[model samples]
Target: MKEISPKEVEHMLSDGADMNIIDVREAEEVAEGKIPGAVNIPLGLIEFRKQDLDRSKEYVLVCRSGGRSGRAAEYLEGQGYQVVNMTGGMLAWEGNTE
Candidate 1:
């Protein structure tokens, strides 16, 4: 899986990039704040649950400080999904959130 900085992601969003961003962190961490519109599917749920995610689009995985999501990305890639990990995770996000 490839790594992408949060700042880079924010810029991409501003430029109207179409991306499928996923928050692989657990629900508890999501309370801290997440990139707006990111889908929440905890890392443990990635195997059976990844099917809920779209395969036709590109996906970016995120988690607290970048650990969990990196693991999720690797798993998704193995599942044949085009996945990228958000480097630094939400800790590095500098844009608006929900």
Candidate 2:
């Protein structure tokens, strides 16, 4: 699966890139903070909520750590969606969050 660093993602966001950012952490975990404009789609619900995603858009997947988002990226890639796994996830994100 393709991967991107947290700093890269932050730069893209700052540049106003039109990419989808999906946070795969649970809702409770998301309450703490998340990348600005990131959509919450916890890992466990990916299957059911996938239809909400646009297959044409490239997505950046994130989690508390890199593991879960990596899995999500793999799964989405298998399903024919373009995806990038954020290497260090939220723990490594020093960007602005909402």
Candidate 3:
């Protein structure tokens, strides 16, 4: 699966790039904070919530660490959705959050 560093994602946001960022961490985890504009879709619910995602749009997946998002990316890719896993996930994110 495709991967991108948190710094790269931060730069993209700073540049005002239109991006589809999905946070696959659980609700409780997300309550802590998340990248601005990132939609929360816990890893466990990805299969059910996937219909909400547009296959034509490329998405960047995130989790507490890279593992869950990587798995999400694999699943989404298998289903033909364009996806990129955010390497190191939130742990490495030094960008603004909401």
Candidate 4:
């Protein structure tokens, strides 16, 4: 799986890249805040919600830190999904959140 920095992801978003941002944090953690357009799926729910993702689209996985998202990225990659893991996760993200 590919690994990308939060700043790079932010730049891509600013440039209007058509990519999917999935946050693998739990509901409580997400309530604190999340990258503006991220879709919260949580690491535990990824397998069950795999079908909710589009195989043809590019995806970026994120979590509180890089660990969970890294695992998520690996799983999605194994499933033949085009995905990248955000290194350092939200802690490293400097972009706007909601």
lDDT of 1 by residue, 19-79 (tens): 7899988898898888888989888888989778778778988898898888888888988
Assess candidate 2 and give its lDDT.
Answer: 0.94
Sort order, lDDT high to low: 3, 2, 4, 1
Query: Which TM-score value belongs to model 2?
Result: 0.97
Number of clashes found in candidate 3: 0
* Candidate whose TM-score is highest: 3
State residue 6's C-alpha deviation in candidate 1, in Å: 0.8
Give the residue spans of candidate 3 off by over 4 A: none
Candidate 2 least-lDDT 10 residues = 12-21
Greater lDDT among 1 and 4 belongs to 4
Off by over 4 Å in 2: none
Q: Tell me the TM-score of model 3.
A: 0.99
Error of 4 at 72 (Å): 0.5
Sorted by TM-score, highest first, which candidate order results?
A: 3, 2, 4, 1
Residue 4, model 1: lDDT of: 90
CA error at residue 68 for candidate 4, angstroms: 0.1
**How many Å off is the CA of 31 in candidate 2?**
0.4
For model 4, residues 1-98, the per-residue Cα lDDT tens digits are: 79999999999989998768999999999999999889999899999999988999989999998999999999999999999999999999889999
Stretches > 4 Å off in candidate 4: none
How much does each candidate deviate from the true structure in C-alpha RMSD? 1.0, 0.7, 0.4, 0.8
